[model samples]
Target: MSGLAAGWASGAQGRTARSPGIAVTIDDFDLTDTPLMSGEERDAAIRAALARHRVKAAGFVAGKYVGDSLDPAVLARWSDGGHILGNHSFSHRYFGGEDPAGFMADVLKCEPLLSGYAGFRRLFRFPYLAEGKIAAGRDTMRALLKRHGYRNAPVTIDTSDWYVDNRLKARLLADPRQSMEPYRRFYLGHVWERATFYDGLAQSLFGHSIDHTILLHHRLTTGLFLDDMLAMFEERGWRLVDADKALASPLLAREPEGLPAGQSLVWALAKADGRYEGRLRYPGEDGAYEAPRMDALGL
Candidate 1:
């Protein structure tokens, strides 16, 4: 086995005791208006929540969402608020079916906008968490990122916050005066469930908890309840770490030999281990998986 693979095998024997840690990483600086809030209002709300909690997050910028207009101001607020910004690709295309060369160009295209920010980092997150479907495409993209001095920002705790936000928006449009408590309840519960599950999976595979990066998006749900979400983690004894510190975990740098290359890093590592098949699910977290449950609950 390769050194990294061996290290993973050795750690899987027993669980190591440690406190859980997580950092918030928001994606897609989509400045489009939503049902409940205007684009600028949504941006202000998210930044306000972060400031209120004194938490520094990493916002991944999708070039397509940003333009010559008010978009730069929206991103400027994030950087000025002590948050880090990373590239999420210009077109935000799924790398799985994309040509490697084209995808690299897309990633490069987004860097200029972020470079002006003091908080910008040479971190790149795969759009949709889909790295590539084949080994060649994956390796090619990896080389491009490495060549550009960019590290792949792997998410460990993945949640479908965007999906929940969609549902909440739909509800609000149907009746703006309706109670938002149910949406809050569902969002918090969904996040906690994914957080614990991924944390447990990491513990089982690594024998300890690694600093986790939870995937969240810039949306109405997040803008409305990010403070609550951060508080929820703290109340549950999970340490809220900075995105820079969380992404610094050495484990996040290790490449798993799993095919179709990406999802949550923890999920990929578990797949490469070949022992957690029964507990694993393809496409780790998705709206489809939560739809029935949400529907059943009338959420």
Candidate 2:
């Protein structure tokens, strides 16, 4: 059986009338400045929403921004509230674009900072999902991570908030009259595309559930829609696995699958029928969201 299939077999053996099939993960919890609140206040606002939903999810935080003490304090709260901390890399730079050694250093710096309070963080989501071209792709990243005992996250769905706010920003610049509605609407529109991308990814990759990880951003724009985000997870009947428990999967023991896939089916399905406004028409659309990628996103 494939490594993916082994997961199905284990789930089948443990199945009961009440067993569930999948789960979702959310991260990229970064915030700098905002119009409505200070950075700390915004963090509190987002945390308030998570607490209110009684939702437990993961936050792939920037180690330097939160600082060691702040990183652990916030992570512990999220973990206690039911969220896990994944690696966003200490710098949150585009890891795939950097020199092999330089990239590994920045990435590894995050863990020791977190380990100062939390111990080693085993799960890694490449900054920006930027796993470049194939042979060169998996060769450097997978090997470097293996050297440090980190697992590459298999992202089945991406909320793509990274593009949303950037697009929102340009809109405000080009057409200053455009109101906050655009940002609000894009934020609200993510849940549908999120599920579609996630489901499509499952069918393509594992042919079944297999603990899929869904990427989310803690960017303030994403915060606008977070209450709904958490509700989607709860309503879907999934629980956030503790990052520690999540890391223990054998999938992490080595490269879970081969390197840089040129196209994940989720992207194709998303292209044809994705309804999430954020992914549907990004930075080009009217919103504070910046950043646009025609090639990488295949839009």
Candidate 3:
């Protein structure tokens, strides 16, 4: 969880591209056995939603989670349907509980599964967001990506649903006052806040149009609330592309011949400017806009 404060650093040279269309991506697709339903069952629900809303979503799945082994058939459904598979690691450890090398190994171990997905690969999303867990951990991970011929996936907006209790329908079920309960914080709210945060962030960052990789969990609660979530997408008129498209990171301009992915990374944490002006990834946040303390990033 400390990764929340410390993300890996990367130095991609690609100019930032923002579009009015939204790119929706969901994580932990193979993650089941909880308040949410099974991955297969969830897929059905998701398909129904896609057809209902005419929007497509990217499913970031664990290669090993499908039948506890690399099941190509299961993975194919997603790719065949035009949904992409994202890497989430072989084992879903709540806490990575190791150093950069250990963390990299944990993620790399799942490469077989990731690469096995329809033979079209090149994207990775940290389980629970590596950026937040280890400061500049994104650097270590990015190095891995470069070596493996993959790219870093950055999430512009995130939903806190997975971390909290299973209140999948809380916002929908909430009364006016209950809805306001989650909004005690100035910028964050309970029910409408998740959607509101992305919607507003989208408006502010790209002004109602931009390619965004949003982090959402594939869980029973989210599955239950799928209808409500899709409604917002329609209201916003965003085109749902495979979430993998969002992993566009800055690359080295020189394009060195044989650099390891770890060697290619910059290793810094990204900080959001409070004024909505711009966001910068730094080693640390200092005095509101400077680099933050690495110690705070769990680096």
- Tell me, by TM-score, which candidate is best: 1
Residue 152 lDDT (model 3)? 56
Indicate the TM-score of model 2.
Answer: 0.65
* Per-residue alpha-carbon lDDT of candidate 1 for residues 17-98, written as tens digits (9 for 90 to 100): 5777889999988877888788899889888877777778999989888885346887788888889999999988888845
Ten-residue segment with the worst summed lDDT in candidate 2?
A: 281-290
Candidate 1: lDDT of 257?
73
**lDDT rank order:** 1, 2, 3
How many pairs of residues collide in each model?
0, 17, 38
**If scored against the real structure, what TM-score would every candidate get?**
0.92, 0.65, 0.61
Clashes of 1: 0
For residues 86-184, write the lDDT of model 3, one tens digit per residue. Answer: 667667554332365675676677776657556345666666554334435445545666787766565555555553323323433443233422322
Winner by lDDT between candidate 3 and candidate 2? 2
> Which stretches in model 2 have alpha-carbon errors above 4 Å?
1-28, 67-76, 79-82, 134-137, 168-182, 233-299
Tell me the whole-model lDDT of each prediction, alpha carbons only: 0.85, 0.53, 0.48
> How accurate locally is residue 177 in candidate 2, as Cα lDDT from 0 to 100?
73
